[model samples]
Target chain A: MVNKAPLLEIKNLRVHYKVYGGVLKVLDGVNLTVYPGEKVGLVGETGCGKTTTMKTALAILPVPPGVVVGGEILYKGRNLLAMSPRQLSNVRGREMTMIFQDPMAALNPVFNVEQQFTPVLKHAAKNHLSNKEIHAQAVLALQDVALADPERLLQAYPIQLSGGMRQRVCIGMALATRPQLLIADEPGTALDVTIQAQVLRLLNNLVDRLNTSIILITHSLGVVYETVDRLYVMYAGNIVEVAPTRKLFSNPLHPYSQGLMDAVPKLSGGGISQGISGRIPDYSHPPAGCRFHTRCSHVMEICRHQKPPEFEVEEGHKVACYLYGPKNQEAAV
Target chain B: MSEAILEVRDLKKHFVVDHIGTFRRQPVTVRAVDGISFDLQAGETLGLVGESGSGKSTIAYILAGMYRPTQGRIHFRGLDLFSENGKRPLFLKKEIQIVFQDPGSSLNPRRTIAQNLAVPLQIHKPDKNIMRETLRLLELVDLPAIYMYKYPNMLSGGEKQIVAIARALATDPSFMILDEPTSALDVSVQGKVINLLMRLQSDLDLTYLFITHDLSLMRNIATRVAIMYLGKICEISKGSEFFQNPQHPYTQMLLSSIPVVSKDEEKLKPAKMIPTGEIPSPVNIPPGCSFNTRCPKKMDVCFEIDPDFVEISRQHFARCHLFGQTQKQG
Candidate 1:
């Protein structure tokens, strides 16, 4: 997989939000990459900038408050940050699409399914397809998501459908354009376990069949474990660990990653593990060195003075913690 | 065995809603909690697991005395809860406390942590020093006493939830109804809250009706587990037994469907059983077994006859046609 060029590459992306008192530095040099047809998981807690990274990549971050301090979002070797509005529009919905956490909020309540689908299909078709063609394609897309009655669903309002059904419709609409990359932000987090399982399975199958690369942003490790091939563990405004899904779960290098893994309640009965104690840092005045230094159990003197760089632990696994740095490696030897 | 702390007999909660049909608006009954019974032993966490609109919250509300049951008998420590009531006695209300799902709304925004905790303390134990009790409650939940001066808006989501828990503890209740308490919090904070709850349960010997949709979390914390479908429980068993040997088809489906984090956990899970369809609306629940519409192991009899609860093993009960028929034959 490393031999092929990345489908989407975000390089040293930094984002800040303007607030009443000062600037909130939300994303601090976040680096991520998604290879063609690869399923990547972006795991993080709330306010960790996982959503900010994706929203910035799509060039959709609201600019009055949001400012990209420095970054380049490269898609197919072209920088999206450099693209014009006209050019970006042509690429946005047709080449890359996104689905939000709440299906109800993602969909327009007043508009019926067909009305929503028409614009998306027309956008993909560049206003060339006829109304009948758009209608048929919408049905096919809904069917692709395994919705039982596509024709019936196309006429129904968003409120009429259940949470699971509305999510399925959103997925169908995102996939309708046949984008090369899909960013799903907590797609099944709002649904029940049973329905979530169904929707996730459907997503996995659809993405595999279409050979589309995907970035699944969620806080649940279990969701990512079943879906994504690779995982990126994000902390407050930075990527803390990156590895294959199994490798990361089996042997997490970063203390934060390990804490996150231990935090999830396991099915096999045991006492609930001790979670991380401290809260996420205030973004306006984040810690100078490691943002996690306040909470990290294995904090070192060097960690207090300098930020740790991503050190390759194995072929694909990399961790950004002082414990995994060369100094620790030398001390261990 | 210890005496049952709470006993619910044939509990039911129904709501009438106007169904807007093609021409006329007609009233329809939503059988939210339809004829369910369970016993909560002293110092046990009975994890009530269910999907949305499955009436888990409704059960929580009824137990917390927020919603009166339509037809049921609730006995708290051998006293009928609804029998003599003009309103539930102050003692009864004090004995049973509730912690809601979202702390953001549960805690009063304008009030400080001290003031929030003071409400229960002042009402329940007016003799006690309010300041001392509030600080003690904060210490109980592992929060700093200094936080007592801070408003709900100042605390983080997890901290707010801790404050909520502390407020619930202010009454010194014997039974607590935790309705999806950690669901609204982050994973990291969720673990913290769960640990605190577990510690409190052991230290105080409190019985809990821990309600949540996440079964994996239930596997660790709950002493016993119950699976609720549309308004009714399909299965109930010991936590270990519930995971190892789920009897009802819906239970199996739910167990199989939960996404596990590890390969070993994946291996222990039941064989994947994809349910046929979505949960039917409560207003239009199927005629016989409510789960028949989505049950993978559904038979013709399931569509026609509602199965009664049959004891599968010691303290393990399931309501399903497959088990009912087997129990009858044996």
Candidate 2:
């Protein structure tokens, strides 16, 4: 079934960082498309450039050490990469927002919740709203997030609230503007099991009502399993697979995706799970062909020399392994 | 039951915070670990599961001799841990060791892997060959012999934790307390650490008090699981039974909340059990049942009367009013 154009589209995103004397190829030829009101999860291990992918697409990458060597980040058919800083700033708070993993770190220690939230609300303000009007808006937003005593909570500093509460406050601040898209990076990772459940549900609920699309980046397969509709499996700065959440969990196509699924211990009291054997290769001197070929169990002769193209095995499902498509269609490899 | 390797009775560790603020200067009594008791049998893994404020970590700290309990008795093979002595008996200290959560902070960054291992070996087994023992420890954790010369910063998070575990085992402790060992690790690397820990447990015949917030982790590693909520063990059951048929409402919520790979995770909506908002501060825990504030099955009596522990089935116990009362005394 064909749908309208994606709300956000990224094509051939290549982000590089200058480390010491040489340039490090962080994100290489990444592609992602997110439709409006859809939930997409970006799952990867540490140093896989999940954060870099999001930051670069959002035009928020720090440029001295980092450089978007090549890429096209399109929002509503407009290229965000080419947008000026002033135009990008306008798009950030109102059009898109982000909720960090650590809410305490995102908030200021000395300032109360009121002071920290004002700047964000101001960016989202359509007209000249008074402090009282903004306070009312903040309280309503806080109440929407199921926080009790909104006025009283506003007077307190970030340190006084619990980790879950701090995150909820951050979520409230993010959704208060009613942005079209929200980017959450490990939003529930710092929370406890029960609290993580609360935060995720709240996020899902708030976004559902507002019809806000989400780009959730997390390492937990379980988090991605329950939360997102679709997800991208990343390895060493390369997106190995992209499929519907349920489909990926049941039958993960890529070898790295399967390895990651096998690594986490299950809750069903099963026998031990096997960990992926090798460490991720150094990105500075990344291996040729598939980034995960070194750790992949079904490594092929062609996999060592040629980079696999993202081949569509089924409708809406794409995999980068040479196990399908190019190797089958060409036979020359 | 097998002879209890370690026993804790009414363990309480309450810290009074002296408030220096101008408005409220009264010292607040934070009930970090309030009246909790559990026993660890030889060669068995007892998993203590809880959130941050649930005081599970505090119990680990007390057992490790990091903090002195305000009231309670911890018997290590029938020896009182808090005997008014500034120092613990060397035998007791050497026999019981604890591994902390953050391997990076727990390990000395300045020292090489060999130097770190040698510290414990020199203190307890000076007569033995230190370098040889260090090399053996490194091999046991699956690290190469070359890693002995490298520092902690050079190793990965999973490798660093493996080294931390090796250092903990240097003195050959029979009883070990693992405090959130794998929580900080990545999913794939976390599996390696858990596998190494299990192999070590069997090889050494060690008794463990494995504490973590990851309830799913207990399904494989823990022989017996103990669910802690607000400084109390809500339920203690075999790992298989614990997930199959959890007794406490709190345990059920935690289990259902786990993000499993299967679509079963979708069935467990957060609205099903877990209450909204953060865990109440330990400084002001609720009266009656600490969890009644959030318990979906909370009744009128739950607000006024606290529940006592009772064995519901063989090898399974729950601390909830749901099972009906036995007596006023626990």
Candidate 3:
């Protein structure tokens, strides 16, 4: 029987990388849930733990340097963090799949596309499928991504294909297994703009047709806006706010979110966009209270002292900032 | 109307590849920047945009006096660069500066931020009070006074980038070439750097040739833009007009391809993406339109002969047969 449950769920997950300096707290108390057929975006700047969160979901982070300090990552009711090495092999690509950033580096140069895709197909098979059967399925997967001549493409190495073509092949390989959850970490960052759009459309269609859940991690608010139904804004390894895409864009309560929105250069020939005032704080020794207080124009004394609780300002809209409190006026710059 | 600050005339850069040993082969000349010309007006930001190895940066380096052009003339302030008439002016060396893409490598890790800032001042005006000027430059880039003592390794990517910019501004150059200056930065920090660049440009009355692959950011910052392909420009226009009505098929694809935050109602239907093909080597570039290999709207003429860039509307230009044919039909 097909199991019916939330595709994946994370509760108070914290991932830290132990560098020579100290324990770098990359992901601090990250809580997320992905229901089937939902596409959510994890938006943040570089080194904000967006990639780490996705890597942890698939148990891909190397253990020697990186460690999951606490919390649970439940995929189909199974604790992925607690899974043994042997058991994890079964669920990794079959139940949860990931498309990494940097398509060029993600693919191996020596292996052809066929060699890379065959193992996933073999792992998912109920009974032993023939080579012909696998080839047919592979062609269809390539075609789904709008890659013409999939039959010939199967024989080409990753080096032979263009950056966009390689990314399409990677997406096709990931989707071939019909994964319950697809976590794409900046899948379109490296491609040319036109090719990037094509990939986004393909991803959108795949999520719909397969009824697959996806978690898209990117630094681009624009990318998040186009593909995600909801967004979780991460700042300095913390989830500062979570809201529906429309609500977040329309009225961003968090100062960081508002700053990010304002930074987007409007195509209407507006003069210089105002950037966020300060840099991302050092993760090893993050500031007290709200991490954003260092740059927030409407910062309060309380913001520098005590961390604000996540408050539900509206239905499906949550913000973590002291400015939204009952006594304070909603400030804008 | 603004006066042109820098002008490039039919600039071309060709690198000849030699395959030595056994097989005696013909030398291949990589047409990195092939016959491109444009004018940069004073106090205006002109964005040069293209994908990886699209020759956008090549044009930038050429304009910055870093790379000598294989053929063509570059004029700064109506003075011919590298002239034989004793016109080898000092301003050519001091007036133009560059802020490169990667701060990690661009900055010397061994030296302090203040020391890096001192290098330019020493090169241009050594007799002045270097320490005071260095601190002032740091303040202009929005760095704390304390950061002058810190090394590049001690600072963040954003901080290091600020130091690089501060150093570039030390000589008080009239023109700057920022090549992917913020691409390495976080979005939050990227915004800050972009804002800083704009502020400096206005305050100093500087001219910029901004090179990047980010369409949205370029749309935000650039006053005018040139869409580059393999060693050639596919389109050029005033920024807002180009974004609003992109005539070149490649430009349309580039703009529409960017995923953006949108209200639910405004989301466009998924556009038909151009097909992917190898970015044919510059060494042996295809005849006619360089974008035709990957262009979805490619016609028979696109592969046979290069199309002439015509003014479709005020200040807007496109180098595509489709636009050319449409003009003729009209």
DockQ of all models, two decimals each: 0.78, 0.63, 0.51
Candidate 3 residue runs with Cα over 4 Å from true position: A1-5, A324-333, B18-23, B82-90, B263-281, B323-330
Per lDDT, the best of the predicted structures is: 1
lDDT of 3 by residue, B1-330 (tens): 878988888889988776545684766678889888889899999999997778988887877666778899888889887565544456677898999999999998899888888988987887999999998998888888999899999987888888899999998999999999988887667777888888898899988899998877787788899999888888999987877677888777676666665543133322454335556767668888887887888889889989888888888888889879878888
For model 2, the local distance difference test gives 0.87
Better of 1 and 2 by TM-score: 1
Whichever of 2 and 3 has more DockQ, that candidate is: 2
Candidate 1: which stretches are off by over 4 Å? B19-26
Per-candidate local distance difference test? 0.92, 0.87, 0.83
Model 3, position B270, has a per-residue lDDT of 29
TM-score of 1: 0.98
Q: What share of the true interface contacts does candidate 3 keep?
A: 0.64
Using lDDT, rank the candidates from best to worst.
Answer: 1, 2, 3
TM-score of each: 0.98, 0.95, 0.91
Worst 10 residues of 3 chain A by lDDT: A265-274
* Chain B TM-score, all predictions listed: 0.97, 0.93, 0.93
> Which pairs of residues have clashing backbones in candidate 2?
none
Instruction: Name the docking class for model 2.
Output: medium
